[model samples]
Target: MKTNPGQLSQLLKKSLAPVYLISGDEPLLVQECCDQVRKAAKEAGFHDRLTFHADHQLDWNAVADEFSAMSLFAEKRRIEIHLPTGKLGDGRAVLERVLQEPPEDIILLLISTRLDAAETRRKWYKELQGKGVHVPVWPVDADKFQGWLQQRASSRGLSLTRGALAIMSERLEGNLLAASQELDRLALLANGNTIDEETVEQAVQDSSRFSGFELVTELISGRAPHACKMISVLQQEGENPLGLLAVLSRDLNLLLELKSAGGQAENPASFLKKRGVFQPQRARAMEQAARRLNRAQLHEAVALCSQIDRATKGFDPLSPWHYLRDMSALLATRA
Candidate 1:
């Protein structure tokens, strides 16, 4: 049974599905849906809850064994299987058994990142969807984001003026986690007063909206001061270091490829255009940014990014965000 995020609450009110598959790229929404299912299961006599992190190469046996094993503590158990990659891998066989012969008195809640169409076409995936409640959460559209902000504020006992809600939507940059946290902050600070633009302005001055695209644009254009400022704002806004690194790494790889291949073409910008640099403004920005650094400096910047990646993965002692700030400064420097 397919379900939209909005219909999840209503679905939970009915008899719970044996398997609940919640998929979304947004971490907050995915977790929220899982929470709803777990809450319903708890109320329906699922007294014990177990959690498993099934990253790409997870041990399927452990999870399968848990599902098949008899419960010791509680008569009914709820098992949460979190698969970040959304790929069943070797675990597909185990999932087949669980779906074909679900545990007699257990609820299986599966949380995964977004799945591509090709992945979704797999027989196992299709079976899971057919057998369970499949909830796919799409991102909120830009025009409707302000409405979401207003709704979120209302839930927190906030009476936000349109102007204030718009301000919050802009500052939050469509990050639900950030928006939720900011709302928590405002609820305490507002002290029963309505939230106005003036209040939001004062509250989010140091922690303004920080988009990865904008941050990379600033650094690529050699605006070191602006890039550094944005980093501070991003940190204050509770941006994830891993996500920031992903954007920077992608842009750096493109720069590296362009630098290596630019010599073959008469016009570097035109060459970049063939590779999806469609917008004139963005093409010009990349071209200008290319002139600011030599191949060696660009290579070094990529190396720094790799180090930041390692730092983020717990292979280094340095903070990933701190290294990312330093890397931005390095990239912004003229060769």
Candidate 2:
């Protein structure tokens, strides 16, 4: 009942699962898996598709009725429930009821964000996995990102030379979405030719614009100007403010973790390696930021993040972008 993307593709060719729980933090991988399931279901005659956004106010009764009702034209249906927060809430009870007498003509597809360890232990989650498939996509880390890029290029009928691969992996960093788009662009530009460093240098524009991860790097290196530039580009690209906040928040918390552990006294590379900061550049940046900012400054930066959130939701008079700029200055400025 548990499968990866490769196995899932092969499995789809043989048979479609009656239910699928596709959850992940990586949007590209999650979307791809869902697309595979959708394609398979359509081929298997699940022509009628209905989508519902699961939230606190979701009408579980309506979903229950739809599950029990036969299609007027006798068409197989796929019901997709998207839970962004990954909490079923009251929907768990309704799903349990429906799964007890699993409907043959209806396929249930639950797409969610990352599920923590606790969520997987719930009875409803286990029951769904017992009856169907659970595909949990994990983010490709820095060590594996180049290999992932190479594989993606091969799939697109383009082969990347070693130097080309190095340029792309460094330019794109760990952002999968950017890497994917760059590969698509390369596929067109190569025109059946192998992508060498010269070809890549000519064809691939820097794809790091889509990376929210870079904002953290910029801030830590005491480059407010660069960080501010990233914020402007991200805003122009319609990047989600909350998503950006999540990125900054995560790194700040990690900095706090290091500070708590006497990071200044310890060697950074070894300290970060123990905590899974595999990328040397990132670990160095984190260490610099930790040593540069005192505890009070770090705490104030975190508080400013909260104000940004409040401002975003209209709880504060200031604009979220305004708060973001202030936080950028706070972290990037030398104390």
The candidate scoring highest on lDDT is 2
Task: State the displacement of the C-alpha of residue 145, model 2, in Å, after optimal TM-score superposition.
Answer: 1.4
lDDT by residue (151-170, candidate 2, tens digit) is 89899999888999999988
Local distance difference test, per candidate? Answer: 0.74, 0.78
Estimated TM-score for each candidate: 0.69, 0.73
**With candidate 2 superimposed using the best TM-score fit, by how many Å does residue 156's alpha carbon deviate from the native?**
0.9
Residue-level lDDT tens digits of model 1 in 216-329: 677777787888898887778666665545445545556766777776846877777766566576677788877778878876775566566557657669877788778777
Collision pairs in model 1: none
Model 2 shows how many backbone clashes? 0
After superposition, the stretches of candidate 2 with alpha carbons farther than 4 Å from their true spots are 207-211, 216-229, 237-275, 278-335
